[model samples]
Target: MKDKLFKNLLHNAKGYSVLNSGGQLVKGYKPDTVLQKGNEYIIMECDTGTSRKGYLGAMLKAARFLSNEKKGVLVLVIKEKPNTKVKQIAEHLQEYLIWLQPLTNLNIVYLIESNRYCPDENPLELLSSEFITTATIIKSD
Candidate 1:
C-alpha cells in the first residue's frame, strides 16, 4: 500500500515532484514521501496500524518540519478510521500548533476499502485515484 501511494504521488500526480522518498533522511527525519509543487511542499507518511508511538512520532516530526519551513502540508494515510485516542491526540496537537495552522495543514487520508456491490473494484484504485484527488483538494485550499 505504501509503495502504491508513493508511486502514485511520484508518477501519476501532476504538478508534483518528488523531493525525498524511500525513507531518505531530510533534516534528521525520514518522511515516507515528500513532494513539491512550485514553492509548496508536502510531507506524507503511511500508518500501517502497528504502533501508536510511531504515529505520534510522525506527527511530531511533521509539526517540527512545518514550524521550520513555514509551508507545506502533512498527510498521514491510514488503512482505516483512527480510533478515539488517535483523534484526541491529533486534536491536541493541532491546538498546540495553532500558530502554524495558517501556513501549514495536517490532512488525514483514510484508505478504507469499499465493500459495496462493485465486484470489479480494485482495492488499490483508492490509493491511485482518491489520494491524488484528496491531495489536489488540499493543495487548492
Candidate 2:
C-alpha cells in the first residue's frame, strides 16, 4: 500500500515490483499484490490500530522513493470525518514520517466518504493539486 500509493500506482493502477537492498523483497523474494484500479492496495493499513505502525518502516522507504521521484501529494482515501480513527492515524503517521524521514517533501490528506471505498458517483481526481481538498465520495441516501 505504501509503495504503491507513493509510486502513484493507486492513481494510475500501474504494475510495480518491490525490490530489496539484497535484491529481494519480503514474502520469500516474491512480489506483492497485483495492481487493481479503485481497489485499495491495502484496506486496513490506515486504521487507528493494528497495521498503522506497519506503515512506519514502509512509509520511510516509500517517502525516500517518492522524494526521488518528486511526488509530494500523499493522500489517504478515508470514509469521512468525525472519524477519530482516521484523524488519529493521520496525525500519528504525519509525525512519524516527519521524524523518520525529515527530508521528505510531501503533504498528507485524509479524504473522507460516506462509502467504505470510492464509488461510481465520484472517483479520485487527478488534476487537483491541493493537498487536503474534501471530496464527496458517495451519494446521499
Candidate 3:
C-alpha cells in the first residue's frame, strides 16, 4: 500500500524533482516524500496506520511544514477516511491556529487513496468546517 501510494504521488508529480524520498529527515521533519517544481515545494506524508496518533502526527507535520515554508503545499495521504478522533484533533488544531493567527498561507491537501492503479481522480474541495479551514480533499481513483 505504501509503495502504491508513493508511486501514485510520483506519477502525479510529473515535472517535479524529488527533493526527498524514503523518509529522509529535513528540517527535523521526516516526510515520506518531498518534490519541488520551480519555486514551489510539495511535501507529502502518507498515513497507513490504524490509530489516531498517525493522523495527528501527519497533521502536526503539515502544520510545521506550512509554518516553515514560504511557498509550499503539504499533502497528507491516507489509506482510508479519517475517523471521529481524527476530526476532533483537526478541530483542536484549527482552534489553536485561529488563536495564534499565523501569517503564513496554509495549503494543505488531503489525498484519500481509493485505487492504487489510478490515484488522481474524484477531486473534491473540503468545507471550512469539516477539518482545517483551508484544507482540501483529493480522492484517488
Candidate 4:
C-alpha cells in the first residue's frame, strides 16, 4: 500500500529507490523512498495516519541525522491533508527548522499532502528551483 502511494507520488521522478535495512545502515538513516534527480537526492518519510507530533518528531530526527549534509531535501509525505491544528503545528515546525538551518546545515524540508495531486499538477514543481524561496510544501486545493 505504501509502495503504491510512493510510486504514484513520485512517478514523474527520473529515478528512485526504496531503501531496506542494509541501505539504511549505509545511509545511516532510512527514508521510505529516495528520489535522485541529477546531483540532488530527496529522502522521503511517509506516514499513514500518525499524529502531528509523531510527524514533526520524525522530520526533526531526520534533520538531525542529516546535520552535516550540505544538499538534498527531507520530505515528509503524509497520507492526507493536515487538519487545522496540524497545519498550525507544521507552520511552527517550519519556523523552527528555518532557525535551525545554520546549526544543522540541513537545506530544505517539504511537507506534502500525498492525495492532493491533480493531473495538471507537476510533482517536480514541488522541487523546482523556486522552492529555494519558501522551502515549504505548498499543497494545492
Top-lDDT candidate index: 4
Candidate 3 C-alpha lDDT tens digits along 1-141: 465456444333546777777565456787776677765666766665656566556655655665544456556555554453334434444543444236444444444342432334532222224233334342211
| Candidates in descending lDDT order | 4, 3, 1, 2
- Alpha-carbon local distance difference test for all models: 0.50, 0.36, 0.51, 0.54
Q: lDDT for model 4, please.
A: 0.54
The window of 10 residues in a row where model 2 has the poorest summed lDDT is 39-48
Q: Write the per-residue lDDT of candidate 2 for residues 64-103, one digit (tens) a residue.
A: 4344445433334443335344555555576665564556
Cα misplacement distance, residue 74 of candidate 3 (Å): 1.8
TM-score, one value per model:
0.54, 0.44, 0.57, 0.60
Give the root-mean-square deviation of each candidate in angstroms. Answer: 6.3, 9.9, 7.1, 5.7
lDDT of 1 at 7: 36
Off by over 4 Å in 1: 2-13, 68-70, 81-93, 99-141
Better of 1 and 2 by TM-score: 1
After superposition, candidate 2 runs with Cα above 4 Å error:
1-49, 78-84, 109-117, 126-131, 135-141
Record all residue pairs in model 4 with backbone atoms less than 3 Å apart, i.e. clashing.
none
Error of 1 at 65 (Å): 1.9
Question: What's the distance in Å from true for residue 17, model 2?
Answer: 18
Please provide the root mean square deviation of candidate 1 (C-alpha atoms, Å).
Answer: 6.3
Lowest lDDT block of 10, candidate 4: 132-141
